[model samples]
Target chain A: MIQNLTTVWRFRHFLLALVRLDLRLRYRRSILGVGWSLLNPIAMTIVFALVFSKILGGDDLTRYVPHLLIGLAVWGFLKESATAGSRAFLQSESYIRQSPLPLGIYPLRVVLGQAIHSTIAIAVAVVVTLVYQPYQPEPTDPLAILSIVPGLILMFLVAWSAATIFAFVNVYFQDTQHLLEVAAQLLFFLTPIIYTAGKLVGKAWWWLELNPVQIILELIRTPLMKGHPPTADRLLAGLYLAVVMITLAAGTAAWLRKRVIFHL
Target chain B: MAKIALTDVSLTFTVHQRKRVTLKEYLIQTVVHRRSISTAVSVHALAGVNLSLRDGDRLGVIGHNGAGKSTLLKLLAGIYPPTVGTREVEGKICSLFDISLGFEPEATGWDNISYRAFLQGESPASLRGKMDGIAAFTELGSFLDVPVRHYSAGMMMRLAFSIATAIEPEVLLIDEVLAVGDMAFQEKAQARMKEMMGSARIMVLVAHDLKTIRKMCNRAIWMQQGRVMGAGPTDEVVDAYIASVTRTAAA
Candidate 1:
């Protein structure tokens, strides 16, 4: 595992170049590039804010709008990683056949590409919260801002691992991407992105803690929106989620990395 | 000290007979392993091969298609791991098997260069110095700025070869990529291939062109059906490989 990390770190520049290549190709014939990609989610966020603000987190547009924005940003990262990560190795079959780099970087390519657009959305969310003076506790720590650095790192770990799993899974089952796309649509409604977590008053609400994404979202949202880092329990929860994901990724990679080119 | 050693190596690919197997079917097959109705059939691409190499070895591999010549190169390059044996390679290996396949068609020649170079393990700092050399070699001029999808096959291959060879390889693995580019560029590519082969500590090439192999390599191997049919001095191997081919044709 350490060796794998070192291999990926050694090729950090390659990953950056691939991400840039993906960015340029994505915007090759289209303008409003990222804005257009995010338009759907941004539109969805607005609709949710208008519909559920009063019903859930209260009618405060300041609090609710930023919340929805952050939620959708993370959702975008998760969704794009699933959809694009499945094609990561398939698209790079030439590279895989030509040389031996760590198989991990291929999925990282997809994760990094998705991360950029989500980063922009997250930045916009932060700005909105600042503009709203943040609907937070009166004595929230100003130093909590530093937590965003760790927050982003944790988010990347989660995204990269999820993408690695999806990439390997898709190599084995060609329809994994199609299945995930349908699954993602269901996940959107099931996740608290459109509906506030606070409003869930039933038995299923207890299992929300098991939703690693919810933990990931709160880690970023607390520091950015509430002007305070999430409580220790939440941070630990995020850490556990990251560990679990990395394990799943490592497991999938161990099983499929060597023979992936055969399938490709 | 670049070196390569394969100890009793074999590679088997379990190719699905179908175009693809869905997760549902795969899961069902896995659960019902004994009574499975799966179409998974294993292809033995390489079988019980032993080879050794060191610095100053320019090894030529000749074989009919599907005889595992390219597979041996890929296995040496670490793209495909051996199923039953150990492969040990030292030094940075640069393989040029599918150099022209990964380019994004909608991206320009310049962009394709960056992408391919990076995949071949060139960092921005390293590529910056080599950019002018690569650009000059392609000679596409303003055409470099145009999307590669618009470029002819020969032009695309030219761009790919230039970028692929930009990295100074310590060990090179090539699979019949010398036959690319236009008439002039073909000679240029041949010279570049020679230059790269000359500089690398070790080089392995898989090709059907016996004359090119005999010219470029001091050592050669002839493979048939995933096994080595001949190995030794290039002249003897080439003669034997030709005899085998002629015998098959006559029969």
Candidate 2:
């Protein structure tokens, strides 16, 4: 574990380069460039808000739009990143075969790139909410500010582990790629991004507790949107999951690092 | 003192030949560990091959396909850990085993170059400064801004080879990469490699072009069926390897 960390630290620049490469490649040929980062989520939020506000008639959705946007941005980042990153090693196998750098940097780069894209999404949410929604500044909500940084960190860890673990599975089973897409889609709906846990306050509430994404959603949402101080439980849960996933991912990567070449 | 040392190094891989695709059979196989003798077998890619290369020694590797020539290059580059025994390498090693392997098909030629270089351990700062030189060397010219996916196989190899040799690695591990590109480009690349050799570094060249090997390498190792058949002066090893191939063909 220490060895992995040391290796990642040494190749920190490669991770940054990967993030830059991802961003450039993302909007390279597009007319909108980085603006699409915001446009994508806002567009989805508009569709959701219009449907929920007009057809469903939910209570004052003015706040809910920004809330939903933030949640979706975070969740979308996690979902798409894991999906893309799961194939990180496979995709970069050529680079791995040619270059002499440490292998972990590729997965880490995948996470960092997604984190940057997600940050752009979050910035869009902030802009839309502050300008149009009349959101009053809540200076005392340190959690809100903390959310910006830690949310990215947590998302990165989740993405790193998800992509790397899937890399292992992808090597052994090519069909795992389709399975991953299905799994990500299911996870998106299962997580309480579209609605609150209170809405499901019934026999099916246990479903929320069982979801690993619940803590992740709450981790970002509690500090960013809800403006609630990060409760000890939420912090502990986030930290615990991050530690566990990182260890598992690192262990799997180490075990599969050299072996993956043969399989390829 | 900078050298690559392989001591009793062996690499074994499990070869699974899928004969039929059935979920029930797959589950049963997973649970029961039942296997038909024909479905799968274990194969050794490299079997306890030991070698040592000191600085300034150009070692050539000649082998038939699947005879572990590429595996040896990968192990030397530290891309693979030996399944059994130890391999130690000391120096900055750069490998051109898979040219254009890491390239993003969607990215521009220049963009791919930087990304590939950064992956090869060139600092971003260095890559930024060296981008123009790499582009010039490849003569990719106006195509630098074009997406790499549109490049032909030869174009891809040109770009890959140019970007790989841009860095001055102390130990270079190449597998059939020098055979890439047009004759002019090949000459330029060979000249660059010759210049690089003057820096007194080790190079492991894996190729079937015996003439080029004899020209570039001082010593050569012939491998057959995952074991070293012969190792000595380049001409002698090449002669023996050719004789063995002739004997096998005659029989």
What would the TM-scores of all predictions be? Answer: 0.92, 0.86
Candidate 1: which stretches are off by over 4 Å? A28-31, A53-58, A134-136, B25-37, B242-251
Supply the DockQ value of model 2.
0.41
For B1-251, candidate 1 gives per-residue lDDT tens digits of: 99999999999998877767788777777776745656789999999999999999999999899999988988998988999999999998787777777787877888788777776667888889999899999988999999899999888888988888888888899988566877998888888888999999999988888898999999999998999988999999999989988999999
lDDT tens digits by residue: candidate 1, A1-264: 789889888778777877887887775676787676667667877778767765555557877787888888888888888788888888877778776788888888888888886777777777776777664675377777678777678889988888889888888788899999999988777778766787766887666888767888888888877687778998888889889999999998998888888888
lDDT (0-100) at residue A105 of candidate 1? 87
**iRMSD value for model 1:** 1.7
TM-score of structure candidate 1? 0.92
User: What's the true lDDT of residue A37 in model 1?
Assistant: 61
- Please give the distance, in angstroms, between residue A99's alpha carbon in candidate 2 and its true position after superposition: 3.0
Restricting to chain A, the TM-score for each candidate equals: 0.92, 0.89
